[model samples]
Target: MKTILVTGSTGQLGNELLQLSHLEKDYRFEFVDRSQLNLASEESVRDFFTNKTSSDYLSIINAAAYTAVDLAEKDKHSAELVNVDGPRNLAQYAKSIGAKLIHVSTDFVFDGNHSRPYNETDLKNPISVYGKTKSDGEDSVLEVNPDSIILRTSWVYSQFGKNFFNTIARLSKEKESLRVVADQIGSPTWAGDLARVCFSAAISDQSGIFHFSNEGVASWYDFAYEIVRAFGYHCEVIPIATEEYPTDAKRPAYSVLNKQKFRKTFEVQNVHWKERLYRLVEEVKGQKLT
Candidate 1:
């Protein structure tokens, strides 16, 4: 069986990939968290790859990233290390070993100035530290290894991690009312669905940048409202403007990505955001019963 190295094994996407690994019996996956493989330290990353047998792994799925948007402003160094240097190191190593590199990125790379959905060829103008670092990471990866596949996604949530879905679910049960931003719009991508796509991309020889997210667009308020409803919570979800909910990081008002290229290239149909969220709610509720 071919080997696939998955970094960030403890994250939402990493856990999803682990859950789906069983379905692909042809590949042997080695999942590792920060403790096992630190991306911040170039020496650490080099040491990990150096000790491994050459050509033992067929691909490296870099799912690890410093995704704290607000905190990234104050913690720029750490973010740059993980977001930029880490991918560069992985790409270089992958190039040396003749292995494919599948680097996961965020939709924040583009400033939400466009009125319509963003395509892969759109120019990137990041507004926040996190976005800038991630954008730099993509550039670094491509420069280091042109064959690397950079998958950009947004509003990622999953049942297994601390994300928007779980946050709304917990708040709905604890409080009777909630307020969410209605202006910031993007697609809510379930981590499980994203993981499956990543796996498919890894096995294929497709390179360059690609965008993937659940079909349909929604604001944060819509997302929270759906979560509350799906979980059978009676919380009053009040929609608020972005000005009402100020944060350290300035997020794009709209960052919806066009998935036409991804769909065409992969020949796969993306599940609607509502349907995926309902499925996740059912799964979470079922887990509670067990």
Candidate 2:
């Protein structure tokens, strides 16, 4: 059986992909973290694939990333090592071995100045160190391996890791009210949904940049409100301006991506953010998910 090597197996999307591993029975999934194949070191990547033939992986889903947006500004070198050099190394190896590389990127690649949704072909003008590294990573992947598939998603969250959802969900239980930035707007993406799309891209012949997110858009405050309501948490979610919650890095005011390309290309549809969140809460309640 061909293998699907998934990096960053501990991440939210990585774990989500692992949960769906049983769905693709024909392919053996090799889920590796930093210990197995550290993307930052080219030597580590080469050593990991040493003695292995070109037919080993059907696709290498690069889910590993240095995702701390604000901290990226303070530590540019670390971010570049993981976000820039990492994908480049992976793409080089994938190209040499004739393997497809499916890379997960971010909507942060755009400056978020547009009132309309961003298409796949939009010129990226990332405003933060994190965004720039991710953008550079995408370029490296495409340059090294033209056959790579790049999926630029926005505001991703899940049960496995720390994200907006987890933060708000926890705060809702502890505090009586929560304040979130209402100015910054973007669609929230569920890792499970994105994982399903990654698997589809892996098996399909598609190769290019595509945007993926939930059906509808929401501000941070809107997302928080829905989260609190989902689990029957009585916390009041208040809308606050971006100025009130200042961060080290600047954020895009509107970064919602156009998913027409992704949906039409994959021939798949996604649920709205609210409905998806509702379903997830209902489904995970029985599993003892916090």
Reference-based TM-score of each model:
0.97, 0.97
Off by over 4 Å in 2: 286-290
Clashing pairs in 2: none
Candidate 2 per-residue lDDT, tens place, 1-290, comes to 88888999999999999999978798889899999999999999999988766678778999999999999999999999999999999999988787899999999999999999999999999999999999999999999898999999999988878888888878898899998999999999899999998988888888999999998999999999999998899988889999999999999999999988887778666899899999888876645334
lDDT of 1 by residue, 104-218 (tens): 9998998999989999999999999999999999999999999999999999999776788888888888898999999999999999999988998888889999999999999
Q: In candidate 2, residue 245 scores what lDDT?
A: 99
What lDDT does the true structure give each of the candidates?
Answer: 0.92, 0.91
Clashes of each: 0, 0
- Model 1 TM-score, 2 decimals: 0.97
* Model 1 CA deviation exceeding 4 Å by range: 51-54, 286-290
Compute the lDDT of residue 194 as modeled in candidate 2. 93
